[model samples]
Target: MLVYSFQGFSQERPLQQSKELPQRTDAPTNSQQPNNPNQDNNEKGRKTLEPRPISEYKIISVKNDTTHVDTALTIVKDYEFNYLRKDDLHLLPFTNVGQTYVTLSHTFNTTSLMPLFGARARHFNYYEVEDINYYHVPTPVTELYFRTVFEQGQNLEAFFTTNISPQVNIFIGYKGLRSLGKYQHILTSTGNFQVGFSVDTKNDRYHVKTHFTAQDLLNQENGGLSPQGVINYLGDDEEFDDRSALDVNFEDAENILDGRRFYLNQSYDIIKKNDSIQNNQITLGHVIDFTDKEYRYEQSSANEIFGEAFETTNLRDEVEFQEVNNQLSLTFSNAVLGRIGGLIGHADYNYGYQRVLIQESGTIPNRLIGDVFYTGATYNNTIGKLAIDGLAKINVSGDFDGNHIQGAISYPLSIGSISASVSTNSRRPNYNFLLYQSDYVEYNWFNDFDNVQTQRLAFDFKSKKYVDASLTFTTINNYTYFAANGIEVDQEGFENPVTFNIAKPTQYDEQVNYLKLKASKTFEYGVLGSSSDLIYQNVSSDDEVLNVPDIVVRSSLYYKDHWFDKALYLQTGFTAKYFTSYNGDGYDPILAEFYTQNQQEIEGFPIVDFFFNAKIKTARIYFKVENIPSLLFGNDNFVAPAQPFRDDVIRFGLQWNYFL
Candidate 1:
């Protein structure tokens, strides 16, 4: 289904984890039977999947499409299972959903700070984004989601699919979460899984897709709190109410990340099906893609307080990475090639092999090998309702050498859609940033940096009824990060006396700019509904090496009805979020990275919530009370630079579906 290279390889890279979805995406399976796809004729025994059009279903983003829809429109959102809660729930707002970041990206990176285990956010390969389906269904399809809060936080998702015949179609999926944090030894757990199949080949020209994915992310590094244990663990007296009994500054720190991926995407159809635009319908294709991946990070226990990060002290911190990809494509389509509607194209070549394994504690025991090649193309167009997308990439040797490109445009209004894009990125450097051997001492290095550029521009608009807006700008040069000029004075000398911190990895030589603005709106009378979101940002070398938070706000108010007679359908809401102030970065679970902190700022805070959403007859329910005035504004919030999110709690959840 080069169906337009699925709209340009899902926007080509940068940003992973951080997620959301499930207003309803039927996919239930308890093992039903009969389906379609994978039948190029097989003597006419299978051939299904055509009778779809509920406005074409939709679930795009098997891994690309630069998904964006949630400037706070609220749904599910119980703080999306908290990865360090920066709010914006479904992720991408100060990242974390399995972690990986270069902050606002335009791809081309290798200033690796081990975004959790690097490879740029667990990419082993298994991406999907082709929605609206129904080819054949008279049974099997399942979905079940769950949520819980304060009971040690949790967020779970499920999936199942059917159709083992009529060609083929199969499925399985899951998303998991765990949070046992109330400060003091905070903890987090994550899991992701996927299973797949798709086909259609009995002459309808060929199409194939396969998937397998598994991910595990774990974290527990409370090296913060403990400047007297944050007033003895959020004290207001009451003996700090046993807040995990306070006391943190690495009590045996921890971090773990594991991943796996497998992929196969196939397509074939090289014109001549009675050409002549098939009487006005044109298409041409050829594609073969395969991928294999693995990423690992481990740290069981080791801590000395930032300065020495980890070199021993009993050792235990590992890193492993592997990647393999092979892609070859040539696709084309047209409903009118270049002026009004329908148009798709992609030209490509990507072959890669990269490996890295480094065990720690005095270095040496390393394994590194590299190979790469690249060429790229992607384009999509439709002029009537406006649509545009374009992307490019280049590399000839080693861990991302150079070149990247991006462009996007969207227009579809009557209710929503407005988009824009621009990008330019130059790379080089990321084989652990040109050699890393770790004996601690700031994790050894051998610098010679240069060539790291960026230029970005963006604009967005969305409205289904009210409003949604966005604007962004970025510029950078050299600008790598992970900084420090070292300081550890105490006893009236001030400086980082508290829980000590120091950093390394720097690269900045001027040129840094950023600007952002966003807005959201929702309102409904009658049954009552209200929503609002706003954000503003500006950074020009922010306090020496960028950190976010200029302003952010969210508000929601609701009331909906239908009970008993309607079998249930109730809703109630109140949500609030506020942001302002900054001083980002300060996380080092033994070099897991997020260093660079200036004194301390993290100011401006506000959080409030009260929800009760319901729907019976297929299940969907959520309840809330996060912060609820924190028993009346008790205060203790910090989404980074010492992590604190998760205090006043009481959350609930459930989601169910099964279409036979």
Candidate 2:
């Protein structure tokens, strides 16, 4: 079904102001001047200067919620110490650092109103506007993240931010990774560069944030293992202990995804309210976003594994998608009414290949170009101890038909918080599913699909004293997916070589009901502690269009203590993750998408890892041994149909922060 883990909600929340830190002036006072002879000698104080608190450095989200920088070395920090710099509890990485991840879970809440571009697998590390974070700091701050990759490369992310003036801030950062994997023709290289600035007017009447990002993700694909290689790998033969010795489908194939984006958001106060009084305030806001992206796959020669091609050599498939959007909004806020806003937006999108394709069956159009106008409203308010938020949007006039509505309510409990939400969406499928042209003759397709409609209701409870749990129920109509049509070949000498297939887009005409329940908890006893997360899912459908594991679990046990007279903090732990067996989706390197397959059921296996982490001052170091179980018991883990999991490996990394 080409389903992957969609993280986070699409709804925008009300921006919250952060508590201001005490301002410290760098200029010396007249009394402290060396020429001031009247200054008391005793005032030449021997007091030691204390460093600024971490809370003075703020990180701001697109929604305007602000949080300070955290340098602490906690278990959560250890979990986030990876190539993506995010917790991978619900994800499984391939052998290389910059490669795509296998989604162990899925979330349906999406923010984009338009159809997304293709190459969905390569976009996990791609940063969107909402993924970017702004910053405010008392002084210049620098952060560096470094980790070792598979074979001969390293992954690093460096960021620096400073305030140009009291009201202006700027930041620049770059994350780069290059990994030569242990397997044949599986190298990955990627980079992301971002520069941004924020400005606030002295009168507090105007505020703006702008950023530009350029990114490229490249991977050399081998189309997984050949049949003989799979047989050798499954046989656990000692001669093939070295992965490089194994045979791959093809060696001269690669794909690249590159994009550039410019974003700007600004707001002006039309009716300002004094801080000392309780009154209504009004603001006018505008946002502009533009992005141009392309995905290309090239092969030295057409391989028989993917079927016949129009041309046998030097095959290339490329697609492009460009979009620009502008929005204007007016908001009013009060102590009682909280905040209410209305917005109108216009979007222009163009997606397709360079030229139209003329085939015997029909003529495939080269482009889908259109403009859309949409209007939406947002409301956020607090009545007594309960908070409420709602958003609704619809396409007023456009070639595309889409709409979204969401509502949420939350209440603070004595220990934690309880929240409930409901959301519904109707949108078109991705552009790739609609129209595509490839060098392979069987890969060309054009289809008119209906808008996919979905609805979800969820409840969540968060607390440390009690278990953190969530329950969600969702229903989907017009589910679209990719399926394979197999073509068997009979050879005289070969014992029925692996079957080749042509993938096609298909839609189910029935409703799918899905329910999910998840829970997490942590327990501590002296210096030893354990944390666990469990998920259970059930899917009910008349047709098998969607598939996922029924259950997933991750648990970790650790010991923490301060060593060397509290000079260093240390934490050591072991984590294990497991899921039930299911018909895992197969990956298509040409399209860079996962397609549904039921030929074989992949048995779930547990992946165990050991980690040792230590914190000294502002630097955190990590050492880990991943996939320990694979080392102890022969290697039999596979993330996809033909993709094998990573073997045991020792890796280390560090995160350091500097305040200047």
Candidate 3:
């Protein structure tokens, strides 16, 4: 609801690694569980943990440290479901308009620290990823969420967590999503399961955290509507009244990605500890992790998508990735450090392997061995907190091409806070990029590419009451972009052609520079609320390569009130967003990438959604009507070059949580 400023952060930072647990006052002794099978009774009231301070809330996201606690002054993000789309395709909260691009953003990013086989487009990053969240509670807790919008799309989630003992906690969660997208022959199915446990000794000297994650993602690729068919819906051609009547490019194309991860972290205190809030103690920890991932693309009737011509047979490409890592760390802290304090040093060893299987080529395997060293320090007081981290990596037997250094610092001001970060990464191209072979014309490639180096600097400022802003500038050298320029002779300008061999950009002299600025503000009235966001972007290259809208604006107005004797609360709002016109990327299903396209410019259209959310006791429900204007009149709001945005949809969702 509001951005945070360090200057206005008044509360004292809670001591790090606090060893405190709330007592279960209501539950009778475990000795009574055998005699009282009346758990079905909400009957005899029991005691539960009192609402803890916001600073005690902890969420283990991939962005931050898993053990770090959350606080009120920490930044808060709007609900990701605001756009009526959750966890699907190149989208993030606060700013995203369903642009179809291979990369999540045309900006700088932190590459995955793990070994990757690079097959992301097919899954939309949802089914192939895992996010871990932790909540501390005295009694068993469970939350169920289900949502359905249109067609056969269904999003369902189940999470349960409980404390086995005062010092031990366990949790298991499942998330399944299946969306038969609005367009033809583009269906997605994903299944994700995770289980984890956290334990601590009675004296809090020894602790361990472990988890197992599995992800299975499947998608039916349609390769976007064919060129001829794409132009039919551009203007008022009256192609069809209903969206389902549209045509598709690929019918038998399918891509499947399977992944499994095992992780464990254990630590023991070697030095003594002080009873004070700040402490002098020594902690040594060990980390072990392993990951196995596989990506496969299958097309039975290649002729349907890409003609049987060009000596192309039924297409099937499979690749597997495996990685193992071991790490050890030592951390020490003292009271003299300030409100927040800590220092840690760590070393890591990693081994990776890859296997690729193309048309009748059998299995081709490759291996790599590497090591990395890291050191980090943090200091915080009532005035402000600062953290710094440095890392260096080298491959013992392979190459030290994947090496980088990153750092960030933040300070709070009187009315707002500001932070800056920088990262430089120089690494060898991914295995898939280096060597690829297939029977299809455009799907086969073998090239030696230069190393990729990308540097970025970012600065952000946030105000507690009014507005927040951030700016990012990225410069990429020797960028390896999946180009759409070159292809087979038969595939050039062919109407409804099935196969496309996009030329890959391997070497470049000029640096690709991209700059982005984002600002948001919220206005409050007596019973009405309004929030607005503005984004501006520019790129050094022509509009052909990185198609970015010059400006994007999103605004929302809402009213909140309680009725039925304050037992029912309601929030009704309408959100509208607009993006300036620009040429964007076009997706190629065969190669699983988005190549540059200078075809049609999609912009000037406004997307609006009417929503109503109500809270009754512990349960919350929301209803939304998305893209009502587009469904009523006016066309040409294509999310990608030829693919249109989702048609009008009536969506509703519910969240019910229980603690027993």
Candidate 4:
């Protein structure tokens, strides 16, 4: 582990000042003295001061971990220069910006006690409570990020924060993107806006924090490519080089997801004591959260690709979800007991369509509305050289029953730290699995499903001198997913028949056992360095329901040095990634979800990119040529079924910070 050092500041006068000079007896009184022209004095006769060290600017996480602003250029910073502003090692991006990503990995660790809203693809950029951060800085700070997109637009994020007083801080931020893809009818536009503030009392006994967010993600869906389009894409003909020239399944369909949220968290210390006097304290905390979201799909005319629909023109389907949650907690802390806390929470939710669907065989209700009460406990302690943490939660009264328990222990060694954890969770499936309604004839259904249970054990080791590695084994029972029901038919085209599958919700009856191991290491010699990341996964089940590639690997070779007499830091690298061929999942435009499919075996191919990054002062610049291999080979790589990967292109971006 790497520990950062922070510079400290003090307000005390210099000791040499008292011994060097003394005030004369005839000198004017303090108020009668003339002020310096360069000095800025407050109403209280104090000079305005600005922080000189970056450590004075703090960023606080939900768990209260504090880290300062960093302005260094490193390999980790280069990997996170994408639209998502995070490392994309375990994810596959779509051809267009602001689009969904294909998941290449899975982790079963969770603390949520309620079923999630469906349309997970749209939630990739959604900001939840845990995603938000609080800031405490001595002066105002601003950050700006900009990047180029595929064809016509750009992506940008702007953030600003300032401290009004020693106890109050506020911030506002917005991220927006607009991109017209190389293909027809695949444009994407998204926006996210957030504003928040944090305040504490003069005595530091009480604190309050609150935030509000509004977000919208919209995509013009063309249902991938038509059968002929796929043929033309793979043929690599010069005439069809322009993707817009190719045909598509439909051109008049689109989907939109919009949401708004308000959150508040406050804490008060009732009994406080200094650690030197008596290491004992008691605190009370409360949290309130509210969210409202809607997902809508619209088409000007119905298309036969999705089967029959009720209306031929002006077809639309929409669903809404709203939730409100409140929690109260009490905690006790001591030198011997560490920290222990208990909490009780209540959640009220409403999810469904606007009207019921009355069919010949059955009737589907309009909505599912209910209230749930839950209780949970948390503990953290350190004994000798080992640290232990545990949490347990269960629903006491609710329409659905769910429980979660997790525990972990970690110990530090001479070079690094090693940790082991175990967790078990039992919860209902997502809202869409239990109930859904759509205009398409094959898309409406309601069912009663059993709770899904999952148990996992994991071990991890972290060391910069050695290697970072982790292994996890998980078992899942009553797994639920979306799959397709295919129907083969002969068309008028001059070739073999084709198959079209309609997506539907389903649950697997047997248990699935899965194991994953990932390791990464870096070696540096002089100015030349090499880094590699590898992942191995295996699945055991009676049926071919769960599928993943057996091997995934990424390697990078780079050169780093300071140029212009150490004023500019530069790094140039080549990165290559590959995975074994497997049966990849298929995407559905109507449901905005990926379903299990075994018909098409997607072949694995290597993708290589060249990047040049540099840091000058408080700015970081990035330049990359993405998918350089595609320029020399055939266009056969696909992120999903019939969805070709992006072509070779040059992209550039930059991040800059300002302090005042």
lDDT of 4 by residue, 306-391 (tens): 87789999889999999999999999988788889999999999999988999997999989899899999999999998999999
Q: Write the per-residue lDDT of candidate 3 for residues 1-660, one digit (tens) a residue.
A: 011231123123322212222212221334423443222324535322233332323445432355523111100112454322342212321111211232324555654333345664544543322455544444455667777834676888777776666677777888777777666677777778888887779988988778888988777876666655665666566655455566656577877878888888788988757676536777787777777777777887555334233444466776666666666666665555432223232323232234343445444334344444433333333333554433444333343345566666777778888888888877666656765654455555555677778898999999958689989998888776666653432434665433443535345556788888888887867678887888888888633456677777788888877789966767788888777777766665655666666655656568788888876654667787877897688555666655666667788887765544
How does each model score on TM-score?
0.30, 0.92, 0.79, 0.92
- The lDDT, on a scale of 0 to 1, for candidate 2 is 0.85
In candidate 3, list every pair of residues with a backbone clash.
7-413, 26-47, 305-498, 306-498, 339-380, 340-380
Minimum summed lDDT over a 10-residue window in model 4 is located at 1-10
lDDT values of the candidates? 0.55, 0.85, 0.59, 0.85
List runs of model 4 lying over 4 Å from the truth: 1-51, 489-496
> lDDT per residue, candidate 1, 84-114, as tens digits?
3234421222212233332322223222111
lDDT of 3 at 391: 42
Locate the minimum summed-lDDT window of 10 residues in model 1: 107-116
How far out, in Å, is residue 517 in model 2?
1.2
The TM-score obtained by model 3 is 0.79
Cα deviation in Å at residue 8, candidate 4? 26
At residue 601, what lDDT does model 2 achieve? 78
lDDT measured at residue 497 in model 1 versus the true structure, 0 to 100? 64
- Displacement of residue 585 (Cα, Å) in model 4 is 0.8
